[model samples]
Target chain A: MITIAVDAMGGDHAPVPEVSGAVQAASTQDVNILLVGKEQVLQAELKKFDGWKKLPIRIVNATEVVTMEDNPAKALRTKRDSSMRVAARLVRDGEAQGWISAGNTGAVMAISKTVLGMIPGVDRPALAQAFPTIKGKPAVLVDVGANVDSSAQMLAQFAVMGEIYSRLVFHTESPSVGILSIGEEDHKGNELTKSAASLMKALPLNFVGNVEGRDLYTGLTDVIVCDGFIGNVALKVSEGLVDVIKHMLKESLESTIASKIGYVLSRQAFKDFRKRMDYSEYGGAPLLGVKGVVIICHGRSNDNAIRNAIRVATESATEHVNDRIEIEIQRWQASSTNDPEV
Target chain B: MITIAVDAMGGDHAPVPEVSGAVQAASTQDVNILLVGKEQVLQAELKKFDGWKKLPIRIVNATEVVTMEDNPAKALRTKRDSSMRVAARLVRDGEAQGWISAGNTGAVMAISKTVLGMIPGVDRPALAQAFPTIKGKPAVLVDVGANVDSSAQMLAQFAVMGEIYSRLVFHTESPSVGILSIGEEDHKGNELTKSAASLMKALPLNFVGNVEGRDLYTGLTDVIVCDGFIGNVALKVSEGLVDVIKHMLKESLESTIASKIGYVLSRQAFKDFRKRMDYSEYGGAPLLGVKGVVIICHGRSNDNAIRNAIRVATESATEHVNDRIEIEIQRWQASSTNDPEV
Candidate 1:
């Protein structure tokens, strides 16, 4: 059974969702869940569910919790026994094969990196999220919000890492990598993308030139790489737009009696649409380039989302994605040095 | 009557949409339309509309056409007699009060900037577009695609210019300006946004701290300012998401017989929803900081959009938004100089 560590004290409403999700995952999957938080609280919360002791779930005591307002670097230095830190430690100690958190994103990255270390030659680990596309499989976006003002070389590394993640996790054969820019032309974006595009061209990966924001949903490429600032803004913009569209649709459907009846009759279709667009269905985004499997979920995630995150963590750990990433990075670095233009 | 020059050869389906839109605008509004293109073709296109001679619309001959694929700077230098250039020339020569185009965004910006000079204190003009918000009035976003790799000073200018445009065009009182970033905190962004926020703080405008992508449609601020790179991506992402959402909704509503019937009954609700989210309702984006009013419509704009663009251009010209922008920019520059921190 794959063993995964859970940061029970993380997220907005922690401990409850974490405990319940652990129970659900343990009941369904052939995995072990180690919930790291205050032992008393986790036990109390787990008791709410039926047959809690019979499942493969346990609570590992953690003394502190990392709040959203804390500075990431400061938290890393100060909060030694924090839930996120303890969870990372569990993975580092080989007690658990993976770690999952829905806490402060920056703190998670800093703590995870400090405890798990980095893959050799990898400067920084990126936050890679799977976005649902209009086409067949979801596309992966790298450096979603991990590092801002990423260098061109770092972007190239993100491209390679993202490509490996897409291929290994999503099972895409020969994933096409594209640099997110204003236009598809070679010389269309700002200085960073221009440099990154040239660097990607030197790599052995399938670099498909530049892509625009519209291509995010079109699934024109399997992996799209960008700096964290742009990636974060793009993700948030999609969320905001989705909220507005749903609100507008709800208001419109309730405006007239006929539309109300129509909404009731088409509820199943709407349910299917919602399921397709649901972020929980894809689970958490993996923090790529780290030495171990670390899945970072949304802070507002519910029990269902937490369960899905645990599932993803189990699969990623079982697949040994980190080992492949390390090997691929070394190969890419060697090949990059061979190219004189690089 | 206010005179507006229409680039009759612009847009995907040119001349047809332009002539018909001009006829519609001339028939309704007290405005004269100068259709700039090949004289014979425009005249023949205009003859299709019933009693077209009675409308205050006429044709001006231009020998050349600027295609979409031409380089912006090269087109400005070579396509002297192009329809876009002629229309801009009419605005520069004071024969027309405003210029409107639905084709070649970069070409329009280049030709308009060259033919009609910039405001005295402005270094580079910005493309500002009003977006529909959940609140009362629409919020405005600046530097959508005008200049990339913009400096902090240029971003501050965009903020000031965007504020003036919002106050004048949207009739907003004391418009609040926010820097677009990953987070709303004072220090939660990349270097560009950080420096830009500090610069905006020194300005005379009502500077709200940093705003995020999720804040774009929330109407939390009246004006959101960013570099062209981020702004352009945000705009395109919204467009792409809207397209996907609409497509999904249509497919869902037609998936089953009951849903198909429900969709037929709820057509009015869907129409109302579309109208609320319609880009034509807000008309075209304005190229601010130019000496005269210049409205740049989308390449895929229909006849209704063209008519609305004419309407917006008339209002902007009559309101003398450029004069306000010049005065506001000078006032901001003077205030910024007085502050030692800036």
Candidate 2:
């Protein structure tokens, strides 16, 4: 059985949603889950749920917890027995195929990278997230917040990784990759993106050239690669805008009696729309390029989000995503050195 | 009377919407309008409207037109008599207090910069556009597509200019300025933004430190400054997302018969929502730091957008925004030299 470890002491609600999600995943999916946290706290939380003892759920005691405010590098050094670290260790020790966390992002990234190590040719691991597009398809955006101030070579690597992930996960035969830029033209981006574009063109991949911010939802490309700085801003800005748009729509819908009644009739449609745009449905972002399958969910993730994250983790492990990434990176590196044009 | 020059040959539907908008602005506002383009063609377009001779409108002949695809620097040097350049010349000769263009953005910027020059001590001019927030108030974003690879010092200057513009245009007292970054912490951004933050804190303006992408719509700050590259990407991305959301919402609302009826009932509310989020309502973005008032509109601008652009240009000239920016820059420079803390 494919076993996954959950950092139960992460997230804002901690232990409650984490434990519930783990139980939900265990009961539904064909995966055993190890809940890593303080045993006494987790045991108390687990007792609240029915059939706690029968489900494929086990608790692993972790002495320390990494708070959201803690510095990632420092926390990783000092809090060796933290829930996040312990969960990563489970994966490293072959006890679990993958690990899921909703902890401090930097800490999760640092701990996962340090414990899992890097895939053979990969210098830095990127965090890849899927965004729903208007075409009802999803595009994978890489380097969301993992590596800021990325070089052209790093961005090129991200494009390759993103392309492979899209092909594997989305089932696209030839995933077209685009570099996130200010404009679609070759002369539009900064020095890094410009250089990255040249390198991408030389690779044996379907590089669709530069795509702007609006393309994030337009389904213009299968995979979009950008520095973590740009990707994070784009993602966060979109999130914020989505919230504002929803709030405005709610206000408009309920402003009048007629519209409120209309809203009632269209409530199902609205639910469908919300589900389409909802990030939780997609679960957590994969910490791509890591040696092991490490999924990082939102810090404010609820039970549903956590459950979905585990599903992603299981699928990633089943697909052997890391192995494919290593193979592709080696292939690309070999081609760049062999091709005279490159 | 304050006179504003309109590039009649600019924009996608040039001389049509441009002519109509000029007529509209002439009919409503207390400003003389100079429609600069090929006089015969503009005259024919103007003849379609009633009472064109009675309105405070006049035509200025220009022989050449700058196509959207033309190289900006090359066009500025070669197309001496282009409509955009002529309008800028009109502003330079004091025939017009301000100029507005929806043509090639680079060409417009180059011509305006060359003709009007820069304010003393201002190294670069930023394009500032107002994004309507959920709070009903708008936040101004500077360097939307100008100065793509900006230095730390340029970003600091943008903050000062943004602050003054917010105070002058938005009628805010001591407007809060924030540097746009991936994270809000002091150590969160890349090298450019990190250094920019330090410089911004030294200025006398109400620097709110660093703001994330979500803060753009949250009304967390009145003015947000960033390098042109990031600003352009953010703005365009928001525009793209807005389009996608509208498309998705429409699809959802029209998916079923009951939802279609609900949409009919909520049509008025939807109309109001669109107007609130409409870019035309905000008019054009000011090319800040130029010696004369220069407003740049969207290439796809309609008659309504053109009319509003003229309104913004007139207001900018009336408020003497350039004068204030010059004075503020000089003051900041003097203060930095005297105070060791700065």
Against the hidden reference, what TM-scores do the models get? Answer: 0.98, 0.98
DockQ of each: 0.81, 0.81
Q: Which stretches of candidate 2 lie over 4 Å from their true place?
A: A338-342, B339-342
Q: CAPRI verdict on model 2?
A: high
- For all candidates in order, state the fraction of native interface contacts they contain: 0.72, 0.78
Q: Whole-model lDDT for model 1 versus the true structure? A: 0.90
Interface RMSD of 1: 0.9
Candidate 1 colliding pairs: none
Ten-residue region with minimum lDDT total, candidate 1 chain A: A333-342
Candidate 2: residue A272 lDDT (0-100): 89
lDDT of 2 at B330: 95
Q: Write the per-residue lDDT of candidate 1 for residues B241-279, one digit (tens) a residue.
A: 888878877888889999888888788999998888887
lDDT of each: 0.90, 0.91
